[model samples]
Every structure is written in C-alpha cells, then in structure tokens.
Target: MMTAASSSGTAPFGLSVLDNALTGIGTSASEAYREVIALAQLADRRGFQRYWMSEHHAMPGASTSSPQMMLARLTGETQRIRLGAGGIMLPNHSPLLIAEQFGMLSALAPGRIDLGVGRAPGTDQATAAALRRRHDHDDRFPEQIGELVGFLEDDFPEGHPYRAVHAVPGPWQAEQNRVPHTEGLPELWTLGSSTYSAHLAARLGRPYAFALQFGRADVTSALRIYRDAFRPSPALAKPRVMVSVSVAAHDDPEEARRQTSSTAMAMLRMFQRKPYALLSPEEVAAYPATLDERRVLDMYMANTLHGTGSEVGVALERLHEQTSADEIMLVTGGHSREIQTSSVELVADHFGLPVGA
Candidate 1:
C-alpha cells in the first residue's frame, strides 16, 4: 500500500517556475520567446529557485521545442536561478548529443544548470515518427539515461565500447592514449507524473519532479513511492520531490476566470484534434460553450488552481503540504504576459519567497 509523508503545520517549500513559452493569440513565436526570456529574467531576479522551460513539438501555441537551445540563450541573460529543461524528452534525441548539449550548458552556467529528463515524445505520434522512425526507438530509456550520465561523468569502464566517448569540451579530451580529468556536470533530475518514472528515479537515486500540470496523477501516491524507494546515488543522498502545478492567478477574480477559460478552451480543442488556437479572452467569449465542451473543460481544469491572490495561495500551500514536496513548480497560464508574470509574482509573494536578488 502507498503511504504519504505525514504533513505537519507550516511545512516550508521552495518555489520555482516552468514556462512553455506560449504564444498569445496575436503574438508571433519570436514574441513568445521574448516573453519567455523576460519571464526567466524576472524569475531569476525574484529569487525563484529555478527557471525551467518545457519542450513541445508541433504545438503552434508553444515555442519551446528545444530547451537546450533556449537554455543557451537564457544562461547568458539571467543569473543565480537554476536554468533547466523542465524536461528534454530523452526519447527524442541521442544520449551523447544530450550530454554534449548539457555539458556545454554546465560549462556556461556552471552550478546553475539543471538537466531534467523525461521519456515522453512531447508531441503527437506523427510528429514523433517524423522526428525519427518509431521503429528506430529502443524503448531502453533507462539504458539511455545510464549512458547519458556516463557520458556526462566520463565514467565508462576501460576498454568499454563507449569508454573513450566523452562530451567534447566536457570533462575529458581523449587522444590516441590520454584523457583529461573533468568535473563538469549539470544537476540532473528525472521528471515524470507516473509511478514508472518515480521507480526509475528511486532506483537511480536522482531528484524527481512530477509534472502534475497536465497529468492525471495522484501526487501524494507518486511522492510516497519516490520517498519510500529512494536509494542514495552520487547525485543525491535523499529524495527531493517537486510538484509541478498549473496556476492562473489574478487579483481580479473574473480576470483569472477569463484566463483560465481561454486555456481550458485551447486544451479542449487540442484534445478533440481540432484547431489548437489559444484565443484571447474576448475571442474565447465569442464562441459559445456547449454543455459537452463545458463539462470537458471543467473536468480538464478540475485540479487547476484559479482565483484571486489569497485563494490560490491557500490551495497551493495545501498542495505543497499534501505532497510533502521539497519545492513547488508553478506553470502559469497565458491569460496574457502581464497576467502570467503577475501570477508568478503573486504566488512568490504568497509563499514569502525572497524578492529582488
């Protein structure tokens, strides 16, 4: 039977930010990226623990297809806050390539870089197949992960097939005979919303971040599995849990509702395989909601934290306590850039996070 960590009164938790780089109704992809950069800078300055970007392909509303590429740009622009791939979707790329990419990032940002990896394709089946033939996949995600860590740590055994392969400009440079000692590696994290990834994380002894933003997962049960099964690895001595939640917060209750509604409609369209346009609140208003649409929207948003400052804060705090999370990762909706930014600030303030680095 699954068991949760007992929660005591006034449990403390760190707060972080996750962005999809969402495109507003009238905004260009470039604009979305600009917003993302600004948001990251703000999050960094505001003393948020980490600023992570998600990866999604073929989604017209999201601009973060390559989180490493985005991190390359972000590391130069922000300071202090950890910059990470809310996940890189490991199945999409080669382990050597990922190690090299993150090794380069760690070189650039050093201790501020985090590599949160996940197994999902982060896109539709057709787009996933387009990325590389589906048959080419090994379903050996765990093996790939081990290989990735090996490359990053330059730890393959002597005479092993991959022993000499190192993330170039990484810790080692292999010549005909010699290799240099290296100590560069990004903080690694395993991300998933299911018990499968939790089990892997526990076995591997890596930090785990649960993506509750869109997952139909029981956060408490997932956390229970992770904490109960954790074993110490070089990366971590104790299990660290981060619960990622969707939030649409505003001082104006109606404004928050409008933003939440727009996001719900956009999600509904995507689920129905229809146009996934993220409309403005006014545009969304023009379309009448059918009973079925409303029902689906309500069900989809059943776990979303929506309301004024105090209202959402209470729920977030409760969630943090219930999951016994080490941190809370907040992914705000694109009600608009202003609302999104403010929502982050609002939550930060609610949780009494340090302001202005």
Candidate 2:
C-alpha cells in the first residue's frame, strides 16, 4: 500500500535510473546510443536524482562496454542529474586508469559524478579472459577497490608501492601541480547483489547499491547486513542503500506486460548462453519457447513490476516501504525506445517530480 505522502504526489524515497543501453534485435547500436542520450536528458529535466549507465562487454544486447566513456558523453548532454557508472567492473581494468578517467569526469561536472565499483566480470569467462588475461583477479576485488580508492584520494601509505603513482587529473595531482581546481572527487559507491559486497561496503563505509534486478539474493537480508556492520568513514557517516528494480509501466497494462515479456525472453536467451539481444514484443510473442524457457520467463515476469503507471507506482511504494532503502534506481524493462521513455515519464509524473526548465 502507498503511504499518504506517496499518494499525494511525493515519493517516500529518491528515484534514479539505471540504463544498460540495450540494443534490440531490430535496432542498431547507433540507435541505442541516441535513445540513451535522450533518456538521460529526459531524466535530468524531469528531476531524477541520478542517471547511471552499466558496463558490459562482448554483449550485442548492451552497447555500454565503457560506461565511463558514456558518462563522459553525458557530461556535456546532461545538466543536473548525477552521471555515473552503475557500475564499472573493477576486475577488468586497472584502478589507476579508472581513477584517471572518472577523475576527469569529476572535473568536468564537479559534485555530480558517481563511481560505482563491482566485483563481477560483466561478461562470460572467455570474454573476461580476453579483457583481463587472468582469472584470479576476481578474487582480488577487495584489494582492487582499496587501490582505486587510494588512487582517487592519493592516500597510499608512505611505504606503499603506489605511493609514487599518482593518478593524473586526480586530487593529489591537481594539488601537486598547483592547479586551482574547484572540482570535487567523484563520489564512490559499492555495487553488489550479495552480502559479500554488503559486508565489504559496510566495512569500508561507502554507499551500497544492491542490484535486485540482476541478483537472486534477498534484498532485506543484504540491506540489513550492510546497515548492521556499517562503520562511519569520511565518505559516509551512515549507511546508504539503493536498490535497483526492473519495471515496465504503460498506459495499458497488457502493453506493459508485453514489453516485460521481451525483457524476460532476453533473460531466457542469456540463461541458455545464447546471444542476449532483445527481440521485439511481436517477435517475443511469436517465438515458441521450450518448457524450461517458459518457466524461466514466468519466473522473471513474476518478479518484475509490470502494469499501468499507477499500478507500478504502488508497487514501487511498497518496495520502498519494505526495504526502507534510501533510493530506488529503476532498470526500465523493454526493447522499444518509446516504451522505455514512456515508462520513465509515467513514473516521474506519478511521483510528481518537478520538471526542470
């Protein structure tokens, strides 16, 4: 049930967006990039708090192989919304490089950049090996995170090996070069779907984003673990939790369900190790799915929030109440650009977000 405040055109929690820049079966990568830019501008103008892009590799369905590059593009297109990597897979790249890239982004849009780091590869084993050339880096995710933070903050111990290695365009570099910079460092957030990330984020006292859209872990347990073990640090004084949810909302409930079906079919294909490109709703309806595939689609749809705008709004309200999350980041589910943009507009209207000039 929605609370009085929520029903009265004010949400109980902050609303944000997580875009994967998905390319559908009939759509080109160029089209996907255009749609992402449009959607990000729309979110910025509609008062959404953040507009974050995901990082994926060797996936035709997702065009955001480098979320930092996409964020760089968004820095010029967007004005108010926070641009971020929803997140960067730390195992695939060097922390110093990530720090340099995001540090430049922070300089471009001071106080509006977020760097969310994750442990997952964001690709299959073969592609991961192609990217990292090593399989053991996943086990060193925590160490990588510390190194990244150290690079961004330039706080490695005096005896540390990287103490002499300053990330260019970073805080330390700016200070050392006597550059008069007003740019703030990118705000760091830890992304995860399990308690391992929750525990690590808590111990490090960074903001935790639990990706319920991708992971099967219980959101409540993960959030509770994070909060319970959280320690105050300079980055954060209290636990901050953001939950990402898959949603498809339309004026017509049936249309919303149809749009959701496309995403479910994509997930089914991904589970089968097939190409993960999204198919159109018409294609999804025509395809003959196997029994197991049908079961998987059913399970995905059951977990997804799909309905008319009001229905989705109510569901979001209930989720906010249940999790007590500080923010809700919507992973809009659909293949059509129109449907996805409409979904965002509808939700924004439901929450009565003040339209930007």
TM-score: which candidate is best? 2
lDDT of 2 by residue, 1-357 (tens): 122235555666888999999887888989988999999999999888899998998887889899998899999999988999989999889999999999899988999999999989898888988895467887888999999999998889989999999987877877888986578889899999998999999999999999988735688899999999999999999999899999988999999999888889888888888878788889999998888878988888877888988898899999988999889988986888777897888888788776667
Q: Could you tell me how far off, in angstroms, the CA of residue 338 lies in candidate 2 after the best superposition? A: 1.1
Worst 10 residues of 2 by lDDT: 1-10
The global Cα lDDT (0 to 1) of model 1 is 0.81
Q: Write the per-residue lDDT of candidate 1 for residues 1-357, one digit (tens) a residue.
A: 112121223437777888888886888988888888899988887778898988888887778889889999999999888999989988888999999898888878877889999988887778889988354453788988999998888889878899867787576753323764343578889999888988999999999999897737877777889999999998899999888998888889789888877777778888887656678888877887888988877865666788876777888878866887888888878548777888887776665555785
lDDT values for all models: 0.81, 0.87
Scored by lDDT, model 2 comes in at 0.87
Q: Which ranges of candidate 1 are over 4 A from the true structure? A: 1-11, 133-138, 174-183
Clashing residue pairs in candidate 2 are none
Mind sharing the TM-score for model 2?
0.96
Displacement of the residue 293 alpha carbon in candidate 2, Å:
1.5
